[model samples]
Target: MLSSLLTKFLLLSCVNHCALAALNGHCPPLGPVLPAPTQPSKHGAVSAAATTLKGIINKTTAAYNSSAVAIGVKSIHESGFVFSYTYTPPDKDEIGTQAVDLDTVFRIGSVSKLFAPLALLKLGISLDEPITKYVPELRALKSQAREDSPVWAVEWDDVTLGSLASHMSGIPSDLITDMAPLGNLSAYGYPAANSSELLSCSGFFGTPSCNRTAFFANFGKRPPAQVPFSAQTVYSNVAFAILSFAVETIAKQPFADYVGKEIWKRTNMARTFATQPNASLAFIPVDDIWWPADLGFEGPGGGYFSTINDLHRLGDAILKHKLLSPVRTRKWMKPVTSTSSTGVLIGQPWEILRAENVTSDGRMIELYTKRGEIISYYSTFALIPDYDLVITILVAGPGTPGEVTGASMDLMMSQVVKTLLPAVEKAGKTEAKAAYAGIYVDQRTNSTITLFLDDKDDDDNDGPGFSISRYVIRGVDVPTTDPGGTTLPASAPPALDPPMRYRLYPASATTMTRTSGSGLEQGLQQRQQISWRAVGTRSRGADEVAARDAQFAWPMYSCVTWATMDRVTFGFGARDHFVFNLEDGGRAMAVEAVGYKVRMERMSPS
Candidate 1:
C-alpha cells in the first residue's frame, strides 16, 4: 500500500533555452550550468495553506519519535509568496535534522522522474518514437519474465518513448529476484533494494553505469519482464533507467550533465544540484532514528536535490509555457492512460490521480502529483491547475507506521483543498464578474475577437447577475477539408463563410463553459465537440493605481485553449485565448493573446 502511494507521487517540470526555443523552432545546445540566484527575503508570507500544514504537522508530530520537521510552500499565482521553515530537534543529533529553509536542497527521490521527460522533450524527441531508436540494445530483452517461456521474443521496438515515460512500457514493475508470481509483486517489486542499491552498478543493474556494452551483455542473457506493446501500465524504474541511458547516449554526456545544461542553468536554479552536494544535509532514517546519510547514484528514476523556490520557479516556467511550447506542455500533461484500477491517469513522468472518495457535494478531486520517498526523505510536488496553485512538500524522518517515512502529504493536500475550495473562496468574494466583458482582438495575428454579454434577459434565472457570453473569432476561415484529405482548390480561401461563434454558459460568476459547434468547419456529419472553461476575471496590486483611478482594475485573464491535442479530436486546430487589459469600467484598452498583444478600441454603441 505504501508502494502504491510512492508510485502515485512522481511528477514533471521545465527546462532552460525556453525563450530561445520559443523564438526558434528547436532547443539550442545548452551552455555551462550557472548557480541559483539569490532569493529576496519573504518568508513571512506563507499562505493559509502553510498554516494548515503547520497545524497538521504540529499536532501529528506528537506521535513521532522526534518532533523536528521541515516544510516548504509557495503560492505564486494569486498571492506571490514563498515560505519555507525548518525545525531542529532540541537534541539535534537525535533527529539529525538540519536548519534549512525552502532553498535547502534534499533528495527528491522519484520526483526526478519529472525531470527526465523534460530533458528528453528538450531534445525534440517524439514521445511516440520507439525506444529502440535510441537504445537498440533493448532488443535483447524479450517477452519472457522467466527463462523457460516457449513464446518467440518480441521486438523492443514495440515499446514507445511515451510508454516508458508514462510507465506503460510493459516492463516488469521491478526486477525479479527469485522467480515469484506476478501476484506477489508487492513482495518483490521494483527498486527491490534500498536507495543505496537502486542505481548500484554492482547490485541490480549488473552493468557499469552508462555503459551500454556492459548493460546489453547482461540484458541479452536474461528473460524479459513483460510482453512489449502491452497497454497495461507497469511502473518500471528500469524503463526510466533505459530512458536515461538513451538520452545520455544520444547527447554524448551524462544524464545529470545534460539536465544541468538544459534546465537548472537556464532557469537560474543555482542550488538545485543533480547530486546531494552537502552530505551533512542528508539524513539516514531507520525506525525512530535519523542519522547522517547517503542515498545513491544519480539516475533517471530519482536523483535530484532542489529547494522550494527553485522548484516553484521551475513550475512557473512550465505553466507560463516559458520552458516549453504551450502545445508540447499540454501534450505532456494530457492523460497517457485510460482509467486504471487505482483511478489514475498517467502523464509523462507524472500521474493525474482521480481520487475515488468524493467531497461533501460529490466533487471528485483530480490531483496532479509527483511524489517521492526513500529511506530518509519523502516529498510531494503537485499542480492543482484548476486552482492555479502548485504545492511542494519535502520531509525527512523515521519510518513511522501507517504513512510512509512519517509523512501525511495526501492528508495535507486534502485538508488544504477542502479549506480553500470554491465555496470557501466565494464566501469571501467581494467583486462581481459584470466588469469582465468586452471586445478584444489580437493585432499581431490580425485576429479580431469579441466577448459580449448575451442579454437574453431571463429574470427566471436563480441568482442576481449571471449572464451568458458569446466568444466569436470573426473573419476566421477555418479550413473545410482535412489536411490529409483532398486538397483545397487555389480559390478556396475566398469561399469561407460565417465566423465561428461559441456560447459560454456561466459555470461561475467569472467562469463560463463553452458550448459550441464542434470545429469551425462543419464538413463532417460527426462533428467532434470541443470543451473550454473561460474565465474573464482580474485582481489588482502590481500597484499601478492612481488617486484619479476610481476603479480598482486589472488584466482579465483566461486560457481558452488549454489543450492542443483536442485539435486532433475536433478536426481543425484553431484555439485562441486572451488576457484583456481594461479601461476604468472594464471597457477594453488592449489585450495580449497567444504570442503577442492586440490593441482593442471600444466601438460607440450603435
Candidate 2:
C-alpha cells in the first residue's frame, strides 16, 4: 500500500512537468524520472524535526522581506526528510499560506549548471575537449568569416570546453544590440528559438544582435586567427546553454533526461526536475513562457529544480563519491581561475567560492562552496571536508540582500559545524579539509593574497609549498601562550583590539651606524643618521600620558616608533590614530582609529 502511494506521488510529479502527448490524457512515460521511495514509518519523526527547522527559516525570511509580496523556505536532509514553510503578508492581498511541498519543482536558474559540468565529467569529456567535436556546424560557421567582417573575423575552434566552463571563451555578455529589436524578440520565449534568434535577440549574453547558433556558425565560416580574451572574468549565461547543447549532442539524449538519469537518478534524487508543468508549484509565481519557447529545453546552465532535502542528498552523494568519482569531484571543486580574475568560475552555472573556516581551537579549515540564485529563489550548499558536514539551504521569496543571505547562512552552518565536530572528532573520526587553498586577487586592486593555512616545510629550498599557510597577513602575528610559559602557536592577530604599535618611517629616514664586537676584535662603522623622534602615549582609562622619548638609540635601520598607553591603531597614508572601547567586563569591543580626514568604521565579526 505504501509503495502504491509513493508511485502515485512520483507520477503526479512527472505529470507536472512532462509535455502532453497528442491523443491520450495519460502522463508521459517515466523514462528518466525516479519515483520517491516509500517513506518508512520511522520517517515521521524526521519529518517532524524538518518541519520545525523549516518554520525557523520561514520566519527569518518573512522578517527580512517585510515589503516583499511573499516568502517561503524548504529544507531537506539526505535521509529523505522534507519540510516547507510559507508566509503571506497580513495587510497585503496576496496568496495565502498554501504550503508548497518540497517535492514541487521550480526553475532552479543557474543551479542547473552544476549538472552540466557533471554531465561532461560523466561522459569522460576533459575540460580541454574541442567544442566542435559535439557541434560540427561550428566549422562551417568559422569558414565564412572575412578579414574585414568584425563579427566573423574571429576563430572559435580553439576554444575548448574548459574555456567555456570557466568563462574564458570571450563570449559577449549580451547578443542584442537595439532595444527596439528586443521588443519583438521578447515575445519569442526561452531556450530561445535558434542560435540566430538568441544571438540577435536574447539578453543573457551581452551581444544584442547575434544569435548563439549564428555566432558559432559565423565563427566557423570566417574564423579570426586570434582574438584577445578579457583579463577579468565575464559571467555568460549563453555560454553555458551552448555547452548544454553540446552535452545533449554528445550524450545523444535530451539534456534534461540525460541529467535526470545519469546524475540525479544515479544518486537516488527523486524530487529533482529540470522543468515544471504547473505554474502554481513556483514559490514565487513566474510566467513559464518568459523566454523564447524553443530555448526552454536548454539545460547547459541553470534549469534544474529540487527540494532542499534532495539538494542535501546531492551534496552527500557528491562528497561520498556516489555521483562522480572522488577525483572528478575534486576537480569540480578546485579553483579553475583566481576569484579576482573571474568573479567566480562558471561551474555548471553554480558559482564556486573558496572560504576559510577558523575553528575556536585555532585551526583553520578551507571550504569550497557553490551558491545559486534565480529570480526569487536562492540556494546555497557547502561541503566542509574537515568537519565531514554537508549544509544546504533553499529559500523562496524576495527578502534578504543576496550578500547578507550568503554570509548569514555560511555563518550559521559554520557555527553548527563548530559545535558538532569536536564531539565527532573525539569519537575517533577523521576530518579532511577542502583542497581549494591558494592565493586569490581582490577584484578592485588586483592585489593577490594567500587564503589557506600553510604548514608544510620546504627543506629542498624551492618556493614555499602552495598549501603551506592558509591566508595570513604578515607583520601582525598573535602569540598564544600555553602553561609553563611556553608559546602554544602563532596566528593572525585578532581584529578585536586596536593595534598596539605604530611606526611611520619617512622615506628619507635612515640608520646611523653599526658596530659588531666580540671581547677582543671589535669593529665600529660610522653610519648616516636621519633626525627622528619616538613618541609614547599610554591610555589611563580617562586620562593618558603623552610622552616623547628623545634619548632613544637610533639604529642604522630606517624606522619610526610610537607607543600608546592603551593600544594604538594604525591607518594607512594620512590617517589619525584612535583607541578601542571596552565592553561590560572591561573586554575590548573593537579596534577604533581616527585619521586626519578618515574615521574608522567598526568591522563586523566574521
Candidate 3:
C-alpha cells in the first residue's frame, strides 16, 4: 500500500499544464487521507534538518526584528510530507511550542476563504449566484425605517459568489465597528441593523437575545427583489460570513462540518480542521486576548490548523486536482476581476500574479507564490511549478517593533526567493565588472587626477591593468577641474614637483606599489623602493620645506605622485589624501590613505 501510494504521488508531482489536464476528473482513490509523515527513526538526520531550518528562521526573524517565526516546505516527489521549522525570540513566551503539529488547530484567518469558494463550487452554485437567494436578511436590512440609511439602500442582490470570492462585492473591508455594539443581537436586530445596538439586541425567535429570530422577522417584513450591482474590489469579512451562513442554509449542515466532510476529509487532509483546538489537543495560549472567543470557533474566515506535512499535501492535492474537478479548480485560481496596470487581482484569498523574473545570462523563469500574515503570526507558501518545489513559512509572536506590519516578511521572502530559486535555472553567469574609469577632482587642491586603464610593462600583469596619472592644475586641459590650484609654491619644478604627483603601480592584482619624486629618474627609483607603509603623519612636508626657506616667502615643495595598474584614482592635498579603489571582479577593494580612513563603494554594472 505504501509503495502504491508513493507511486501515485510520484506520478502526481509534476505540475505542468499537461499534468493538470490529465487530472481533469481524477481524484486520489477514496480512503483516509494519509497521516502526517512519520518522524524519522534516525534522530540525527531529523535534528540536523530541524536545527538548520530553525537557524534559518531565527536569522530571518532577527533580520526583520520579528519576535518569532515558523517555516515549512515539502518536496512532493522526494519528501511526500512537509518539514517544519520555527523560531521564537527571547522576550516572548506566549505558551506555545514553536513547532506546531500539522494537525494542531489555529486561526487560519482569511485562509478560510479557500474552503468557502470550494463549498460554493461543489454545490453547483455558479459564481454568479445572487447572494440574496441564499441570505434574504440583506434585503430586509435595505428596508430600515432610519432616514440615515441610503435613500436607495444597496445590497448584494446582484453580487455573485464569484465577486465575493474575489473581493469585488462592494462591501466594506470590515463591518466590525458597525456591528460590535450589537454583540449577539447585531445579526438579528432590525434585520437591517447598520449600528452596533441592533446587532446586540436581536436574536433567533424564542431564545434569550435571539438575534436570528428578530433578523428573520425583520427580513420577512421587508419585500425582496434584485438590486443594482456595483462592482469594485473590497475586502470584507462580513461578506464571507454571510456566504458561510448561506452555504449552511442550503446544505442543511454547519459550515465547518460541511467543509470538513466534503472537502478536507475527501482530499485526505487528515491534519486539517475548521475549528479551534479543544481540551484534548495541546494549544499554545495566545497572550493578547483581543480576539473574541467566538471568532476562533467560527471557521469561515479565520479558523484552521495543520502541520507542515498536511500543508504540503494540500499543495499537492491542489496541484493534482484531487479535490475539486480541474475545470472548477482552475476557475477558483483564475482572476475573476481585471486589474488595472498598477493593480493586482485577488483570486480568493490568494493574489493572482506572475512571479518576479531574474535576469541572468539572458533567460527568464517564473515562480507563482502566495503569502499570508495575521497579527503576530506570518506565513508564506510559494509554488515553483517548473521546479516542482513548494516553500512555506509561518511565524508566530510579535513581528518587527512599532506598527505590526508585513513589510518585514515581504523583505525576508524577497531575499529568500532571490537567493534560492535562480541558482537552479542557470549557473556560472559571472557578474559584470565594476566601472572605475573616471577623473576625480579634489575641490581643495584644484588638481585633477586621471584614472586610466594601466598599460605599464610591469611583471604583475595578473592585477587590474589600470593606473592613475597625477596632472598639475596647469598641465591638463580638462573640464570640471577644481578652481583652487595646489598649495605648493609656484617655484616648484613643473615636471615632477608641480602641485601634486603620486603614481600607484600595481605589483599584483592585490598589492600596490607607489613612487613619488621630483623630476629625477634616480630619485624616482629610490622613492619607489622606499617601503611606504600606511601610517598617520601630522606634518604635510610643506612645514619642513617652509622651515628651510627662511626668507618667509611661500615654501616650494614637490608634489607626490602614485600610479596603480589596478583601477584607482589617487589624490593628495595639504590636509588629506584619498585613493579611489576599484577591481574588475565586481567587488569593492579598499581605498587607503596615509592619515585618513579608507572607504569603498560597490559598483553595479550599468
Least accurate stretch of 10 residues (summed lDDT) in model 1?
28-37
TM-score of 1: 0.59
lDDT of 2 at 602: 24
The C-alpha stretches of model 1 lying farther than 4 A from their native spots are: 1-53, 82-97, 141-154, 175-214, 220-225, 282-298, 355-365, 402-407, 421-606
- 371: Cα error in model 1, Å: 1.3
Q: Which stretches of candidate 3 lie over 4 Å from their true place?
A: 1-56, 63-66, 80-84, 90-95, 98-105, 145-152, 179-231, 279-286, 290-292, 296-298, 338-343, 359-373, 381-388, 399-405, 424-606
Q: Measured by TM-score, how close is model 3 to the native structure? A: 0.51
Candidate 2 local accuracy as lDDT?
A: 0.42
By TM-score, how accurate is candidate 2? 0.49
Worst 10 residues of 3 by lDDT: 27-36
Q: Is candidate 2 or 3 superior in TM-score?
A: 3
Model 1: residue 186 alpha-carbon error in angstroms: 18
Q: Which candidate, 1 or 3, has the higher TM-score?
A: 1
Give candidate 2 regions above 4 Å deviation. 1-59, 64-97, 142-154, 174-230, 285-298, 341-350, 361-365, 398-606
Q: How would you order the candidates by lDDT, starting with the best?
A: 1, 3, 2
Residues 329-404, model 1: lDDT tens digits: 8678777775455557778877786642322222234667788765566777776543345667766655547333
Whichever of 1 and 2 has more TM-score, that candidate is 1
